[model samples]
Target chain A: MTAIAGKQPNYKVAPPKSGMTIKQQALINSIIVNAIVILLVLLWTIPTFGLLVSSFRPRDLITSSGWWTAFVTAFQSGAWTLDNYRSVLFADAMGSAFLNSMLVTIPSTVIPITIAAFAAYAIAWLEFPGRKAFFLVLVGLMVVPLQMSLQPLFSLYQATGLNGTFLGIWLAHTGFGLPLATYLLFGYISSLPVDLIEAARVDGATPMLTFTRLVLPLSTPAIAAFAIFQFLWVWNDLLVALVFLGTRADVAVLTTRLSELVASRGQAWHVLTAGAFVTMIMPLVVFFSLQRFFVRGLMAGSVKG
Target chain B: MRSVQLNGGPVMALFEKTWFRVLVSLVMIMALSYGFMVSTEFMKNQDAPRAMLAIVAILVGVLGIWALYLTVDNLVSTFPIRIRDFVRPFVFIAPAAIILGVFIIYPTIRTTWLSFFISRRGTGVVPGSFGLQNYVSLFTDPATFRALINNALWLVFVPSFSVSIGLIIAILVDRIRWEKFAKSLIFLPMAISFVGAGVIWRFIYFRATFGAQIGLLNAIVELFGGSPQGWLRIEPWNNFFLIVIMVWLQTGYAMVILSSAVKGVPGELLEAARIDGAGEVRIFFQVIIPFIMGTIVTVTTTITILVLKVFDIVFVMTSGNFNTNVIANVMYQQMFVQGNFGRGSAAAVILFIAVIPVMVHNVRSLKSRRF
Candidate 1:
């Protein structure tokens, strides 16, 4: 961190006053590190790039053309076209599924964060009995696999007449998500300096007032970080929505809808690629907007929001 | 002391003064009423012809008794003259607790119970007494035994490999200028859901086996004059390919945590080591690795749990066919697909039991960590 410290900004800098050979070794070391990073990045990005490219190229071109081959005439047997995107979007069948994803993602994200914030604040500030035991259980919920309880939950949902309903999915997501959210927010918010709350309290603020006026502002970074994760989880969810949303196209999420699209029209790789990218838009937006805080917040280890 | 008595402590304390005892008595009386009333109602409905309604009534009757006391308390002076110190936190965590218990805990117990019975297609319930028959059959069956072994392999390789790579990256990236962007690039896979990533990898690993080759992997192989092999169709080895997808998705998460832990290593210690003629490799192992061991263990255990319950990837990729079945996916087939809820539930119970030892140890370690 202090490498740039005690340095003159305008002067040409000399390195370590070491021997020429050592300096050469350091330069070589940096190159190797950068080269490895570049290679890894290409390996990671090429497939997605290929899919994206294949999505746009005429279907046959995708079969014959390397995504990287677009650079040459030999690979360019056909011109690029929007046929796949048009088929997925203008085609009345898939458009509604896109809307359905919106419905699930929006509410699934909002309700959990709202409830968690309130509960987290209470756990953080409010004194009560069995708090330790409750905290323990909340953390433990993180370990239970969703698939294990899924059958019993299905039966329960059936009994409650919530099977195959948006409301049911909402409730299920909230139920599954609450434990982690509370544990995370509780860990973060509770560790905030008690002086902030006490200072507010001394001014005759009630608990609610103290939380809203003092705690929430400080905890915003943590809340935002969790929101990004929960939003992505619910958005990219397939099995949860599949079991609860039923086979109906009208209620299925982007994931379930996309998988169904794959089976019914996997031939149309064009739309699948576009649709995948479209589904990716929200998370990418969320990630970029909160990128700086992402590392800091995660690194803070839930102890500081 | 005089003020304590005078202020309604115990100077021949009036009913209001001694209301704590009264409240306790009232609670006991309400609980007794609830138990008796619920038992009577439950007995009345025990003979109900419809199985579902009878079960519902049994549940409702028991819950109704507890509801009655809560209602009665609300109607009267719910709060004592002095607020109960513990009530506020209960109010805070109560909603979360109640939902988790009903949804998570109750279902867990239900699964364990159902595992004991037989729900074959031949009968509504597994028509027999409870024993270790299902578990015994599970272990004895060659197919199931293989799946159990595969799941164990996943537990060993997926978490450990992903975490190891993450540790390596974290160490490497800490020295880089564009660390955040580089880290996010790796983390990008995690943003894609297992299903979404599964869809993408399917195409990458796509094998037509004949005609014009399209899959990127096979396409590249053919480009290199290598024979096209159906990657996903290969047994045993195919599991490693599947594990790669999980590694791809999770390495970023592990990286973020481990990177943070790596960063948390004190600079002075590393600087001192450097002064003592320690090379970068030695300093990393001796200083950084030891500091981050706790976090690495936590990440490993968490990822192990994920691996043990691994379902979606196998389901989406191989559909658990071709000997790629993990425990959770197999459980689904047995319970839902095969309609052998007993066997399925048994599979689930076994998985749960397998997890408890690790889960208990994790909770203990997590709690034992100083705040």
Candidate 2:
């Protein structure tokens, strides 16, 4: 538990000479890496970019003209509409469905994080009865495919009468989200200095106070990082939402909307594209906002090897 | 109870109090039981087909959670200490337990039962015989056979390539000056929702352009003087191509994790190896790999689990037809499309079993992580 006093091992990757103007060399190196990476990003983005542009084009243009021609046809081919967004968000049951997605995602993300943070704290610091077993259960539960649990859960829900509801989907998501959340947070919280918590407890701080005042605050980088993770996961998730929420239009989430956007046969291309974008947006927001916390060394050598 | 210290001992008498951990555990059990009870109402009214039942269940689950407060009071009385000290973690975890019990555990048991029931379609065989007919059909039907092969192909290839590419990229990027930015750009694909990635790649793999081709792969193919290919319709080859999207999306995630582990590899170890005349490749294979083997396994198994449950890309791309059907997508087809709950449950059960081993392995390594 002592601070991992070990320094980073030395290596032969030579630093530039003492007077070699390292700033210019570092700049050159970074630019080379950035250029290559920017190229990769373009390769990754262009196709999706094309799809997003195409989704806005008129249906005929979507089927015919390349999305690139939007620039050339700027003078004459004026066809872009909110119709797809309108249909995706406000379609017969979709407005309510969007609301339903919010309900499911919010509670799902919140519940797991709350519990995982606490359990993670306990696992990390609190010496308690059944700690190892409880930790093991969380770890073991991580791998149980939700699909396997679906039937058992459905019948249980049916018996209890919750087979299809916003709450059902929320709980399902929270359940699935917990294991990873606990593992991640526990991994972070455990690495924190023990003396800080011990010292506070010596000063008569309650566990809740300690968590709020010390553990939680110190764990902000981890909590934010995990929130982004859980939010993205629950947002993009379809299976649990589909199973627990059923196909009820009022309760269908964005993923369910994307799923249902397909006609009885496949080919609902127009709406599917819009629906995909809708689901992508929230996660993108969460990702960009919390993206900074995912920086490495959050817990560098908190534990010695 | 008076003799107990203020700080809790690891093995404190769990059953010493009349209603200690058991009481809180019971309250948790009922709250979850109630959540399952209430949520079905949302599915029921003609306008709200299942609303009342869902409401009652959730209310019972959520509001009734106050029972734990009673247990908290019990602990405070018996011990004269704030039971919130003991109960708070359990409280934080209660919601997750309730959700899991209702939505996952309950339904899983239900699906297992449904797998024994007969299909409503009554097309394939005499529906269900409460036997293993659905499962037998999985190995028997040519379509099912192809689906299994396709899934197997995915299982075999996706993780192998994703890990390899991820490792390669991680190693390459680790050596770069702008490590974080480069990794972020590579990880960008991961942030695109899986459904969006499908749509994204669909455009790249778009086929048969009479007038204008916007699809990048095909555009490049044309640029190289080759005819545009039907990327998703390339029969046996199509499956691998479809899996490439998963690799592209996941590689960055694997890279981020692996790169951290790689960074954790003592710089001295690699130097020590080089001192012994080991080349970069040799050092990578020797010292670097052994050090990160645990993380590598965890990442690989986690990806294995993901690949096992893959339905989104397949559903988005081909709707599991034209040689891309996985168990999850195919199950969705049976349950929703065919309205045959029995067959779908079987497919889901199969998917569940397929994931269990990798899932188990993943969890074990996760708990035992050295870093």
Residue B56, candidate 1: C-alpha displacement in angstroms:
29
* TM-score of candidate 2 relative to the true fold: 0.75
Judge the docking of candidate 1 as incorrect, acceptable, medium or high.
Answer: incorrect
The residue-by-residue lDDT of candidate 1 on B1-371, one tens digit each, is 24555687554464444466466557766776776565444433323333343343334333443354333333233455346333534544555667778767888888888788776644757456687777877899888888898898898889988899888888878777988778888877766767677777877887764466677888889899998888988987999999988888778778989988888888778766766667788887888888888998888876777677777788777778888888888788887678787788889887788777765765676676544
Writing each residue's lDDT as its tens digit, candidate 2 over A1-305 gives 01232244324544566566656876877787667666765665666677778777766676676677776776674577667777767763556666666666666666567757766886777655567766776666666666666555655566665667666566667677777777778888888887888899899875656776799888887777766666667777777777777676766777777666653423444566677777777766755666765333222211100
- What stretches of model 2 exceed 4 Å from their correct place? A1-39, A56-60, A69-97, A117-131, A159-161, A188-220, A264-272, A294-305, B1-132, B175-178, B208-210, B222-229, B265-291, B335-343, B359-371
Q: Which stretches of candidate 1 lie over 4 Å from their true place?
A: A1-20, A73-78, A90-92, A199-205, A264-268, A293-305, B1-80, B83-89, B120-122, B209-211, B365-371
List TM-scores for all candidates, in order.
0.81, 0.75
Q: Candidate 2 chain A, which ten residues in sequence have the lowest lDDT sum? A: A296-305
